[model samples]
Target chain A: MTYCVAIRVDAGLVLAADTRTSAAFDDIRTHTKLSTFEYPGERVFALLSAGNLGTTQNVLARIARDADTPGATASLRSAADLFEAADYLGRALVEAQQKANGAAADGVNLEATLIFAGQIGTGATGLFLVYPQGNWIAASPETPFLQSGELKYGKPILDRILRPETSLEDAARCALVSMDAAIRSNLSVGPPIDLALIRDGDLRLSHRLRLGQDSPFYVEFRETWSTELAAAVRGLPPFEWEAPRAPPAP
Target chain B: MTYCVAIRVDAGLVLAADTRTSAAFDDIRTHTKLSTFEYPGERVFALLSAGNLGTTQNVLARIARDADTPGATASLRSAADLFEAADYLGRALVEAQQKANGAAADGVNLEATLIFAGQIGTGATGLFLVYPQGNWIAASPETPFLQSGELKYGKPILDRILRPETSLEDAARCALVSMDAAIRSNLSVGPPIDLALIRDGDLRLSHRLRLGQDSPFYVEFRETWSTELAAAVRGLPPFEWEAPRAPPAP
Candidate 1:
């Protein structure tokens, strides 16, 4: 299990993912779930993945292998637009799952869900959520974010704070706070966390960070957020009945 | 789907539950999920429920009926301690589900989960989470809370704010905040929340509140929480690389 979120703000896109993968409680491992595709000033894409490790790895590996091969038919570089890039990713995910299931015996589901976020050749910045069924949906103006895997614990913050006009830095901080909430509430999602900021129209990555468990920056972020949240709770108005209580009968 | 939570603090116990119940999108209704059993100064118990509405209603009705009947075996009033009451409630739940499932033809589950919170006689005040399988687990000093149904969205706040030394009012506030979070993140959990507070050693009820959708206090609470949460997000520290960025290449 993992938690990955991508927000499309007016200034840029912010994408983040946790690194914990657990087949079972005892079989947990840390794996990077964020993959980036950059063609310098031409195009850039960041793929945040969650689901069956083998399937995601295979899909990612296939995409990278294609990119490395000169004149490959279906690579991020070959997509004509952000929509086409999402479609290509969905196809790769389906093919990878089908190929893996074909070799196995039982009725196991090797489905994987991904967030395709980036800029494509000066096109409007985009964020698409690719489903396990080889289809995708892009974030709309009203809802400028997409998330997958262990999402609920971290979602309320994003729903409250994110908007198209939110600054790039604020969006990135919101993502980190959201991820921190998820990591605290759930065991399946852990650090190190991977984050990337792609500024709108720049076609170049502004920030790419990997925060391990003991990283000072991540620790401070978590602690400051926690303290402020507690303070927020403390500062809420008192309940109507809080001050006026009936006396206990003698 | 529903969301019910119980938090046990040194001052007392705080329990809350949403009122939404849905079999389908079109089949939604508001039903009270919080039940209280009070023997006045001798004892008081609050039961918060989630899961199959029919099963929960049946279990609740049976518990009430047994208590009304004279000399009924294993009624809530007859239980020796909070643990015994939890055990009795679990048995009632299992009995109700088995009775319902026995009558149904298709493979339908009539399972229900409940949080049994209150004091029994002069014994220790307690909170127990009763599972669908008729087993129960008590909340400890360290954990101090139990939640059921659509729980993840609201859990991070509880994990951060709840402690053995938290005030009853604060605990109730935390419960409301948690419930609000769940309601916002998931459609299945909705308004008209019920809250109850039981002070340890007091034995009688301290506070019982039913917050309807249009209730002014509820509305105020929700607004305050949202505003404070947004402010908290704004106050988070900026990313380390946020200030230093190279200009885009010409």
Candidate 2:
């Protein structure tokens, strides 16, 4: 299980992913789930993946392998727009599925979900959630976000805090808080987070961070959030079952 | 879908459940998932359920119907301890599944979970998570919590805040905060919550609340938590991305 979220706000986009993956309680391991494609001022695309690691890694490897191949149908570099780039990714996923289908006959689903977002040119920014079938949906101002992996645990914070007009810095912070909440609750999602920020129209990565167990900011945020939450809970008026009743027979 | 949680702390026990149920988007409705059986000064048991409402309702109805029946194998009234009551409830769930198996073949899953907690005799209070197959596990100081239905979204807060020494009042407040988080994130878990508190050795419920959309405390808590979380996020130190050197002129 993993938790990955990407937000498309007015300020830019915020992307975050957890590193823990587990086959069971005993077979847990840490693996980076965030992949980036950058071509300086030309294009920048980030992919946060969840589901079968083998399938996602294979899809990513295929995309990277095709980066330098000219006229190879379509590559992230050759795509003229974010939509085309998403389509190229979708195609790569489908191709990978086809190649792995024969060995995966025990009904193990080789599905992988990708949240792809970034800029392809000046004044052009896009965010898309790509499915295992290679189809995708672009995020709109009304939604403003996309999540994959073990998303349910951390969704409420996003729903309540995210907005189209939210600042990039705030959105990124929200993403981290959301991830923090997820990691605390779930064993399958642990430390060492991958977070990225892309300012609208920049066509260059604004921030890429790797937060591990010892990250000072994360430790402080977790402790402070817990303290404030406890305080907030205590501050609420105590509920009474019934208006003070006199003792029956002392 | 549903979200029900029960916590056993030093002060006592806290139980909370959401009311949303749906077969599809258009087929959604509200139903109470928490049921209470009170023998006044003798015992008080609260059952919070999730999954397959039909199955749960059937299980409850069966228990109520057999409450006064003589020699009933494991009726709650006949149970000598809270553990026996939990076992009875789990058996009732299995009975419900068997009774509905034919109907289930048409698509519905005749499965449900029950969180049963209360006091029996002069013993300490106890809490158990009952499975559909007549098996259950009691909450201990080591774990101290149990949740079912759409559980992932709200689990993080519980992980960070819950402890064996947590006060009953504090646990109740934490439970509500957790539910609020779930409601904000998941469409399948909604308002009109069922909340209850049981204090140790009291043999009577301290607080049982049916909090709805119009509840001022709930509304205020939700607003306050969201605001505080956003503020906390902003307080975190910002990521200092490495600056790139000047690129060649176009």
Candidate 3:
């Protein structure tokens, strides 16, 4: 299991993902799930992956291989636009799953889901969720976010705080808060959290950070959020009967 | 689908449930999911249900019928203790599911899951989660809460705020917050919300409240929580570079 989220605000895009990967309770490892393909001042793409580690790795390796292969027609760099990129990535994901389908007789879910967000040739910025079946949906103004893997625990915050007009920094903070809640509630997700911000029209990542469990910033953020949430709970309106009760007759 | 939660704290027990029931996305009805069997100074039990509406209704009806039957040997009134009651309820649930199993041949799920909490005689107060297969698990000091139906969206809060030493009132508030989050994230769960609290040593429920969408207290609580959460988000520590960026060279 994994957790990744991407928010597309008016300012730009905020993407975050957990690094913990577990084949079983006893076998766990840390592996970064965020991948980037940057062409400096031209086009930038960020891919956040979740699901079968093998499938994601295969798809990613295929993309990297294609990019490195001279005159390859199926590389991320070859896609003309974000939509085409989503389509191309979806096809790659399906191909990876199909290539591994022969050994998936043990009922292990070989499917992988991904969030593809980036800029293409100075065109409109886009964020898409590529499904396991090779279909994709782009985020719209009304739904300015996409998430994959262990998403429910963190979704309420996103649903509440994200909007097209939200600032990039605030959206990024909200993503962290969402991820933090998921990590605390579920063991399958953990840090060194990876976060990247791509400002609208910047054609490159504005900031990319990896915060470990004890990193000062991550620690401060978690502690503050926890304290604030506890305060929020304590400050809720008291139930009518919670007021002081009269003493029984002496 | 529905959302129901029960929290057992040192002070007492807090149980809440949503009322919406849906057979399909287009067909939704409001039906109470929280049912109380209170025999003042004797035994008290609150049942919070989720899953197949028909199966739940059948099981509930059977329990009510058995309790009313003149000489039923295994009714709620006849159970020797809380464990016995849980056993009886679990069996009833399985029986209900079996009775409807034939009609459910089309793969429509007839399984029902429930959270049953209350006190019987002078024995310790208890909370049990009854599964569809007629098995149940009791809540303990380490895990003082149990939830059923659309549970994930609301779980992080409960994981953070609930403890054996939590006050009953606070637990109740937390349950409301949990339900509210679920309602916001999942359309299958909605209001009017039902709440019940049972204080230890008091065999009967201390409070039972049904809050509608327009109810003054419910509305106020929702609004206040939303406001406080927005404030909490706004108060998060600013990222270093978010302080203020210099105007870009024109």
Candidate 4:
């Protein structure tokens, strides 16, 4: 299980994911779920994934292998646009899933879901969510964010804060808080957190961070959010006919 | 789809639920999912349910009909304690689910989950989650909350704020916020919200509220939470080398 979210604001795109991967309760391990590909001024892309680890690894390997092939015209490097990249990735994802489940009998779920966001050219930024079934949907002004795996627990904050006009840094913070909410509520979404920021019109990632539990800024970010949320809850108008809250018992 | 949550604290118990029920997107309806049975000076119970509406209605009807039977020793009135009440409710749920699906051949889900909290006597308050299969588990101080249907979206706040020493008023407020988060994130969950509060060491409900979208306090609660949550996201510490966030476009 995992939680990954990506937001496309006017300023650019922001993507975040947790590092925990759990095969079973006792079989948990840390695996980075976000990868970035930068061709400097030509193009830049960030891919975040969740679901069967093997399938994700396999799809990603195919993406890297094809992109690195000399004179390749069908790889990420040669995609006509961001939409084509997502479509290509979806095909790779389907192939990987089928290959993994081909050996296992029935009940083997080797599906994976991914968020693909990047700038294919100047003024051409896009975000998409590729489903396990190989279909995909692009984000629009009406829906500026995409998520995969354990998405609901983190959706409310995104619903309230994300907009096409939101600043890239603000969107990154919102993504982190959303991930923090998922991590706090579910063990399967542990940290260190992975975040990638692609500033508008830039052809490379402006920031790529992996914040562990003890990272100074990460610690302060989470603590501040927890305190602020508690204060917010306390500040809400009370129901009519309610008395003042009493202090806790000793 | 429904969203229901119940919290047990030192002061008492708080339960809240959304009323939206959707069999299909076009067939949406509103149905109250929380009920209270108060035998003043003897016992009190608040039940919150989620899943199949027909199955829940059937189970509740049986509960009411059986409890009303004269000389009955196996109804809600006859339960010696909260555990017995929960066990009884689980059996009723299983029976109802089976009956509803018995008419269909297969692939028809008729299951419902319930949260039952009550006090049979002084110092006898307890909370239990009754599963669809006639099994149940009590909520201890270590885990003083039980939720049914669309639970994850509302859980992070509870994981952070609920404890044995929490005031019932605060717990109730938290419950409403939890419900608000679910409503904001999903169309399957909507208003009016139903909330029930049971004070410990008492034999009757202290508060029972049905809040609609237009309800003054409910509207204020949602608006304030949204404002404060956005502020929280904006207040998080920025990463190294980050630029100041720009204001929204005019």
* Candidate of highest DockQ: 1
TM-score of model 2's chain A: 0.90
Please list the Cα RMSD from the true structure of every candidate, rounded to 1 decimal place: 5.2, 6.8, 5.2, 4.2
- Say what the RMSD of model 3 is: 5.2
Off by over 4 Å in 3: A68-74, A101-108, A242-250, B69-71, B101-108, B242-250
Which residue pairs overlap in candidate 3's backbone?
A: none
Instruction: Give the backbone clash total of model 1.
Output: 0
TM per model?
A: 0.93, 0.87, 0.89, 0.90
| Candidate 1 error regions (>4 Å) | A68-70, A244-250, B243-250
Ranking by DockQ: 1, 4, 3, 2
lDDT tens digits, residues A1-250, model 3? 8999999988999999999999999999999999998987899999999999999999999998987888887788888888888998999999999999987778889999999999987688899999999999999999899999999999988887788998899899999999998998889999999999999888888999999999999998888887778777877888888885455356
After TM-score superposition, what is the CA distance of residue B79 in candidate 1 from its true location, in Å? 2.3
Interface RMSD of each: 1.1, 2.5, 1.2, 1.3
lDDT (Cα, tens digit) per residue for candidate 2, span B55-138: 888888998877768887778877898877887788788888888896566766778889998887687888899988889998
Question: Please, what are the lDDT tens digits per residue for candidate 4 over residues B128-233?
Answer: 8898889999888987898888888888888777889988888998999889888877789999999988888778998898999999888888888888777877
* lDDT scores of the candidates, listed in order: 0.89, 0.83, 0.91, 0.87
Which window of 10 residues has the lowest lDDT sum in candidate 3 chain B? B241-250
| Docking quality (DockQ) for each candidate | 0.68, 0.43, 0.61, 0.66
lDDT of 3: 0.91
Task: Report lDDT (Cα) of residue A22, candidate 3.
Answer: 97
Residue pairs with colliding backbones in model 1 are none
